[model samples]
Target: MCRMARPRKPLLSRDRIVEAASALVDSEGLDAVSTRRLAAELGVSGPSLYNHFRNKDEILDAVADAVSAQIDLSMFDESDPRDWRAALHDWAVSYRAALTEHPHIVPVLARGPGRRPAGLRVADAVFGAMVGAGWPPAQATYIGALMRYFITGSALGSFARGFVDDETAYDPADYPHLGQAHLLAERRRQVDEGAFETGLRALVDGLSVQYELLAPGGTVRPAPKRS
Candidate 1:
């Protein structure tokens, strides 16, 4: 004659808490994530989350770094030798793909790794790969920073949003070059992807040129000495 309360759903923990918070941010943007809302979403008391995270900021940091963890860092981990340019190109593509999946987190990521384990791992992998390929330590570090700057900056906006179908927006009378600007919106996927590929190749090529001059045949090989 006692009606027991329905078995409570699995109680929340750090991973579940982070997962729910991440879903919230992905759907509604970072501003929408709050301790109260997160607690409600998980059907737990607000104070319970504190047992796992110190505050909303801590949770947000975890969510941001979760994205960093998704990147493919194997190029640095593998024992087999790889062409530096090919390794860099593949890693950048993987990094870009991971970042694009969580575009909402892009702005917060520029806080610069900030002691997050996964974020630090990503930076370490990139720098190690460069240095292992014969890049001078200083140059390797700067090149890593340069790639991060380009990838994160590009993630801040969508190319599709930049175009307008309205021909009036690009009047030939005022600007001749932008006459086909309206068409860009129709080809957003192609244009955005194409632009990233072009820029990445330019960076790799330019770096290769510098490496050849400094180290000779390529970044990893040394020039022959005159007899």
Candidate 2:
């Protein structure tokens, strides 16, 4: 003569599983996202996750694709095609911002775009915009790869985060070159932003110069600096 048990909550779905897995990555880092952990997070049995994703890799791929969806693709124009320099700069900014938000997932995405739809979409948007702007196929592909390299490397968070703020971390007599290492941490945000912009400007500037030779007036240059 006991009252009926309250109805159980809904079982997990692929989307829910991926979302939970992503949250695990966001909160605890990549190692925290496992089948067992995801199941626990979803309040479901481990086997239920396999019903949606064959394994952790597939689940991660889905999570990565979801991240790609967060990237901004408005750099490419439908009505008034923007110059390729501006498009590339826009792409670099957007890509960096997206990956920076999910640094833990960056390494996984570096495996290559492959058959992941959203990752492919990001790659396609960048490559297609360049091709449409008259970049040679190989060069366009190479440029796409270059941007990925920069963005992913930047996302890795090593020296990119800057050296320790403790001046004692480096002894000037022992390491004269790093005497100002603490300054990096002192101005962490400014340092990181300045480095990124410097690298971006240099990359785009070099590409612009080369593209000029490759397409001789392809994608009109803008002020010979950061486009």
Root-mean-square deviation of each candidate, in angstroms?
A: 4.2, 5.1
Which stretches in model 2 have alpha-carbon errors above 4 Å?
1-7, 160-162, 215-227
Per-residue lDDT of candidate 1, residues 1-227 (tens digit): 99978767986788898899889888999999999999999998999999999999899899989999998887676674667788888888988888888888888787789989999999888888888777888889999999999898777787866988787898888998998888888888788889999999999999887787675433345557999
- Residue 4 error, candidate 2, Å: 13
Winner by lDDT: 1
Error of 1 at 62 (Å): 0.8
For model 2 the TM-score comes to 0.87
Candidate 1 local Cα displacement, residue 80, angstroms: 3.6
- Per-candidate TM-scores read 0.89, 0.87
Off by over 4 Å in 1: 1-7, 215-227
Q: Model 1 residue 96 lDDT?
A: 88
Which residue pairs in model 1 clash with each other? none
